[model samples]
Target: MPLFEYRCMKCNHDFEELVAATGRTKVVCPNCGATSVEKLHSVFAARADASPIPVPAGGGCGRCGDPAGPCGM
Candidate 1:
């Protein structure tokens, strides 16, 4: 359970929080509760001109899960 992206430096208010582990965790700024929170460097991006989810070459496709088949890279 790790999802934490917070930026509310007293009211800049951007949020996402579901963290169960990370040292000294006391992040609080649900729009102006303001523990002066700032931890924002989250990244997940995929669309460098992307189109490939055709995904059926057998073997369940949980990222190269090869049960003796279809794990051809």
Candidate 2:
């Protein structure tokens, strides 16, 4: 399941719901019980503990000297 954000037009309420991806877009407002709700784009967070592999400045594989950089890595 993915979390979706919604805003109620009638009551101007904002909330988030855990819903199925194929579920209906028609959501009821919890504050006023209004069906006039607009689905919102949700933001997500990600974390990376590992550093990115550095690309050679010469534009090629530093170790094997492949011009395309090891099949573009």
Q: Which residue pairs of candidate 2 clash?
A: none
lDDT of each: 0.65, 0.71
Q: Mind giving the per-residue lDDT tens digits that candidate 1 earns over 1-73?
A: 6676779987798897776665766879877787888778442222322544334556454446655654435
Pairs with steric clashes in candidate 1: none
Q: Tell me, by TM-score, which candidate is best.
A: 2
Which candidate achieves the best lDDT against the true structure? 2
What candidate 2 gets wrong by more than 4 Å, as runs, is 45-73
User: Candidate 2 — what's its lDDT?
Assistant: 0.71
lDDT for 39 (candidate 2): 78
Cα error, candidate 2, residue 14 (Å): 0.4
